[model samples]
Target: MRAYLIAAVLLALAIPVRGQAYMTDSGRAEFDSRVPLHTFTGTSDVLVGRISLPDSTVDFYLDLETLDTGIGKRDKDMKKTLETDTYPFAEFFGKLVSPFDPAGGTQPAVVRGTFTIHGHSQALEVTGTLEPTDDGLRLQAAWELNLDDYEIKPPKLLVMKVDPVQQMRISALLLPESESGT
Candidate 1:
């Protein structure tokens, strides 16, 4: 199926590589959603990303099913809202527009890419900070997304309803594929 093929390709992208390639592990991704009465953030540690300096390529993805908002019932509702079965992953692939020196200190970075979720894709440009770490690089980025843009209908029941706009953020320490210890 298409889903399986996409998953395979994403997995391949996360493999170890040589020369100017940085891979992410132990990364975290979060989406903060607000309702009239409350706000909750669904988080996951299975975030995957790769940066190729030679090509200025930046790519990232996370399994939707891996996210947990802390409550079992709410988590179930979220999966249903996201239709994770049909679109199992959220992904971004784009080019880095700003300079990134792995040996340098923290610097502002910009990336332009297409963010895909719920089988919908939209062009986006995100600004973040990239810092050189003892072992590799650390990336901190945040962006706002509207569920309507992805054709995702916000869940609603009784007086509880989720906001259509979500605040998305990610933090990852990217290490050279060789240094990532696979």
Candidate 2:
């Protein structure tokens, strides 16, 4: 028993030895509506995300209520119709499958991961350009997510509202951790 306890402690201490936390609170996620009739856009604050550089894995979360389309009524309608209160957050977790030489500067990379929204998680791949700036890292990519994947029914209030598909754009700035406890 003593040996088992020692091993558990050692494993816990070892996990953080090479792990780092890079958080970006101001990361912006925008969704655009380019249907033939109306065009809309909104912004949201990314709650928290961390990258395990040693393992090339990343997981992030966003507050769903942060969505804004520049119009008040539309926003209210969306919340009410979509039941934002029940599904307040969305999350994405995936690994950076491509080789990333952050110290070498800017380059293009593709990240494959899973995205969870409205309680449903699905596999997704996003290709984007990455630039390691003096302050942190900048990643820009856009992808289309089918609302049905997450069971987000098309808002049908008053008829002729909402789009069949959602186009999302993400621009995130992730700062590197100063040191890894590991």
- For candidate 2, write residues 1-182 as lDDT tens digits: 99999999999876674434455777789888754577888777655566666677877778878888788897887777567788777788998788888687777777789998877889999877778787777777788988877787755657566675888888877776553121
Q: lDDT scores for all predictions?
A: 0.89, 0.75
Model 2, which residues run further than 4 Å from truth? 1-20, 157-159, 178-182
lDDT of model 2, residue 103: 84
Compute the lDDT for candidate 1: 0.89
Tell me the TM-score of each prediction against the true structure.
0.88, 0.81
Query: What is residue 100's positional error in candidate 2, in angstroms?
Result: 0.3
Best by TM-score: 1
Task: Write model 1 residue lDDT over 1-182, tens digit each, in one string.
Answer: 99999998877765533546888857899999999889999999989999887688999999999999999888888888889999999999999999887778999999999999999999999999988788788999999999999999866778787789999999999998777875
Q: Relative to the unseen true structure, what is the C-alpha lDDT of residue 122 in candidate 1, on a scale of 0 to 100?
A: 99
Candidate 1 residue-pair clash tally: 0
CA RMSD of each candidate after superposition:
8.8, 4.3
